[model samples]
Target: MNPIDTDPPPPTACFTYGSLMCEDIMAAVCGAHAAYRPATLQGHRRHAVVGVAYPGMVPNADHRVQGVLYLELPDSAWPRLDAFEGEEYERRIVTVETDGGAHAQAWTYVFRPRFAHRLAPADWDFDHFLRVGKARFMADYVGFDTLQPR
Candidate 1:
């Protein structure tokens, strides 16, 4: 008889650079907590979205974005995450390098091409966000209460 194969499929991974990098916000939106690590994505830039507390990422060959890589999120999380990202972003797969220098593929929300004009000229600062923006973002972002899974 042939040997039985019984390995579970790997979970989907995500790379987040903005407010979603905060575990509190991520759990509140996705309804699950995930293990995460520091990572960097090449050929991209993270910029402050004008008049908002969060940032939006776009492709920029000259830049690299530092973020967090979340692992093993339950399948149920994607729809809520998608709803939270709204029409302004489109989720796509990209490769990221972990702090340990290992490369992995993960999904990331990228700002849509039409909204590229909304990005500020300066890069978004994650430390600044933790210091001044997290509270405001958690309280005011309308998407939290209205996530309709598609």
Candidate 2:
């Protein structure tokens, strides 16, 4: 009997904002067949702050955060992703606008301000996040510590 047989598959719609935005991480976290779509959430911004379990931190605000929306993933993978994120972040229903101008309601993680703070950078460094910080930061979602340096 193989342990692989006991574990289920991954989820279909797993959104990636940080390191997971990179194709390689996505493939590793989810699976080969997972497809990612460029999507945006209106009135929400991504910030780097308050270091915790994951890497840095991700907190939402009135500003918008640009990210890639993953397709629905297998249910089996949800637990791993959820555990990686932890309790500070809560899964919520959100509307994501795709490049095609279609709005779809999906689940996303949000950090509580009472436990954390807002990200102060004028804009989030998506490229930098994709390259070095995403994977480390996204392992856990915490409130913002401060803004990214200019």
- Once all C-alphas are superposed, what RMSD does model 2 give against the true structure? 10.3
TM for every model, in the order presented, reads: 0.89, 0.66
lDDT tens digits by residue: candidate 2, 1-150: 797778543224655565556676555544345667998887666656444212223444656767778776666455555554456566666778888999877667776655455444445576766566665654543322221211
lDDT of each: 0.90, 0.59
lDDT of 1 by residue, 21-112 (tens): 98888887888899999999999999999999899999999999999999988998999999899899999989999999999889999999
Per model, state how many residue pairs clash.
Answer: 0, 19
State candidate 1's TM-score. Answer: 0.89
The deviation in Å at residue 96 for candidate 1 is 0.4
lDDT for predicted candidate 1 compared with the true structure? 0.90
Best by lDDT: 1
